[model samples]
Target chain A: DAGITQSPRYKITETGRQVTLMCHQTWSHSYMFWYRQDLGHGLRLIYYSAAADITDKGEVPDGYVVSRSKTENFPLTLESATRSQTSVYFCASSPGTGAGPQHFGDGTRLSIL
Target chain B: QQQVKQSPQSLIVQKGGISIINCAYENTAFDYFPWYQQFPGKGPALLIAIRPDVSEKKEGRFTISFNKSAKQFSLHIMDSQPGDSATYFCAARTNDMRFGAGTRLTVKP
Candidate 1:
């Protein structure tokens, strides 16, 4: 497809297990973002990459790590997933021109028991 | 802390009625404000947006009203329909983006 896509639409892992969510976009956007959507919290940014190898922390970056080795791929990893981390994760991309609209993938629903 | 605050955690409106959602922010540095709509099991998609310089921007049945001095903005969906039922989020952008808690709207037929 020509849009953003996330892998393993649904995932389940143990509290101490490590899990990774993959995000790939064909648009080659300059900005890629990872967010977690939970009830009553809307969407909170976990991490974002301005460009390949250039990443920054967002509102809730603890316990979550991200790397953008390629402009088209930005992956998020949880070193030790916790039950509190169970939420729907979304990946988005933007052209990075001031205030450009972001294109989002369907999202990955992760559960940690 | 949530930089953007949204009101009316949930809303219900009859078909053809108007649906309104409000959001407030304290950061004057945020120059762009955008609203996103999400259906069940799907990521949010940009619905409409407006800049602080503009008071109002309308596209189809969706409208965004911005009040720069009050640090507030709103989304108004006219003639709401069942298809319009979804979760809507309002966000403010600076170097990073901050999103409101979100509003779930349900339209009754």
Candidate 2:
């Protein structure tokens, strides 16, 4: 496919374990975002990157880490996974911050026990 | 704090009826509004969008009503169908895009 894709569509890990979810896009977008969708709370941004090596914290960044070493890849890491972190994680990319609608991946369903 | 507020967490509309989802934002800087639709096991995709410059925009059976003064926007689906059953999210874009809590819409056939 030509759009964005997330690895390990479904993941399960224990609390305190280190887990990384991978996201890759073929569009070479300048902006990439990571968000977690939970019941009642909707979707909340976790982290985002403006460009390669330019990542920043989002609304809920605690317990999560992200790095954008390449324009096409942005990976999110849970340094110490917690049960509270169990949610559907979505990765999206936009041509730029002020550009058009963002394109989202299939999303990674992560379960922490 | 929630930047955008959506009403009626869940909605059920009879087929061929109108389905409306409303949202309000607190930020005046937000200029762009978009609605997303998501099905089970699928990612949300842009359904429709509107800019502050326009009061309304329609694409086929979907329409977006924007009120810049009230900082409110809404999505209206005409002639709703079973295919329209999905989660809808409204988002506003300022320096960043903030999404609403989302509405689970069911179009009963």
Candidate 3:
């Protein structure tokens, strides 16, 4: 497709297990971000990548790890998924890290049991 | 403190009526303001956006009114339709984007 896509639209994993959410964008945007959305909290950024190998922590980065080996893919990994980590995960990308509009993927609904 | 605050956690309006959602921010450095619309089980999509330089921007039936001095902005939908029913989020961005808690709007036909 021409836009961003997220894998495993729905996922259920046990606590303490590792889970990875994948995000791929066809636009080859330079900036990619991962956000977790929960009730009362609109969208909290977990991590963002400026370029292929440059990444930074966002508002809520604890327990989540992100890596961008290529411009088109930004994957978020939960080393030890906890029940508190159960939330809808969204992946977005923009042309650059500056003041630009972001295109969001459908999102991955992760449920930790 | 919430960087961006949105009012009216929920709203209901009849078809063809106007729907208004308000948002305010504390940061003056925010140069870009964008609104996002989200449906249940879906990611948010950019509805409209405006810069601090302009007081208002309109696209189709959606309009964004910005007040730089007051650090506030609002989204007004003219002749709102049932299809427009969704959760709307107001966001401000300088280098990083921060979104409001969100407002759920339901338009009944």
Candidate 4:
């Protein structure tokens, strides 16, 4: 409730379907990020937001879309889910874009079949 | 291409022993290096961090040894305990952050 929280701790969906993963932070951090973790690959950033209405792509943002309408909410949407997109997604927030420590959410385990 | 590379995908150690995890980075612009610890079913939390200007930083029983020339850094846990068993991640940061593959450490009780 006080820190960042992600919705749908577990999710199962089919290919070519649209799915959205939600992230909310109570700290109102200026920066928020989304990452997908896979075996051996670690955590690859998908998208990041510097502030409300501003978002940018990260290393693995190809199939993912993110929007931050409000400072407290950043949701990641899979336009067309694919099997390769199945992974544990984590949301993080930081006060600024500097080298500050980021706070991470518990993460959402998404499975695409 | 991976910007950060980590080793010993997994490790096992006895209680009271030392646990070491190494990481290497190719980027010189990285100004910050941080280590994160993650428990099962939980998100990763920052354990220790160091700036490039500092070669070594110690906190409690954990230490970070950094080599600026070699662009390498390591995390050492002294007096390992079963409670320390978890996945540890090393990360480097510039304008954005890049994380290492991660190492799963298991300290036997």
Clashes of each: 0, 0, 0, 0
Which model scores highest in TM-score?
4
Q: Which has the higher TM-score value, candidate number 2 or candidate number 4?
A: 4
Compose the digit string of candidate 1's lDDT tens values, residues B44-108.
99999999999999999999999999999999999999999999999999888889999999999
Q: Write the per-residue lDDT of candidate 1 for residues A17-96, one digit (tens) a residue.
A: 99999999999899999999988888988999999999999889999999988999999999999999999999999998
- Candidate 4 per-residue lDDT, tens place, B11-71, comes to 9999999999999999899999999999998888989999999999999999999999999
Model 2 pairs whose backbones collide: none
Cα lDDT tens digits, model 3, B1-109, are 5689998899999999999999999988898899999998788998899999999999999999999888899999999999999999998887678889999999999
Give TM-scores for every candidate, taking all chains together and pairing residue i with residue i. Answer: 0.97, 0.96, 0.96, 0.98
lDDT tens per residue, model 2, B1-109 = 7899998799999999999999998888887888999999988898888889999999999999988888888999999999999999998887667888999999998
Q: DockQ for each candidate?
A: 0.79, 0.65, 0.68, 0.73
The local distance difference test score of model 3 is 0.92
Query: What ranking emerges by lDDT with the best candidate at the front?
Result: 1, 4, 3, 2
User: Residue B94: error of model 3 in Å?
Assistant: 2.4
Model 3: per-residue Cα lDDT over A1-113, one tens digit each = 59998999999999999999999999988999999998777888899998999999988899999899899999999999999999999999988766544799999999999
Instruction: Name the regions of candidate 1 deviating beyond 4 angstroms.
Output: none
Q: Could you tell me how far off, in angstroms, the CA of residue A81 lies in candidate 4 after the best superposition?
A: 0.3
Q: How close is candidate 3 to the true structure, as a TM-score?
A: 0.96
Q: Is candidate 1 or candidate 2 better by lDDT?
A: 1
The list of candidate 2 runs beyond 4 A from truth reads A99-101
* Model 1: docking quality category: medium
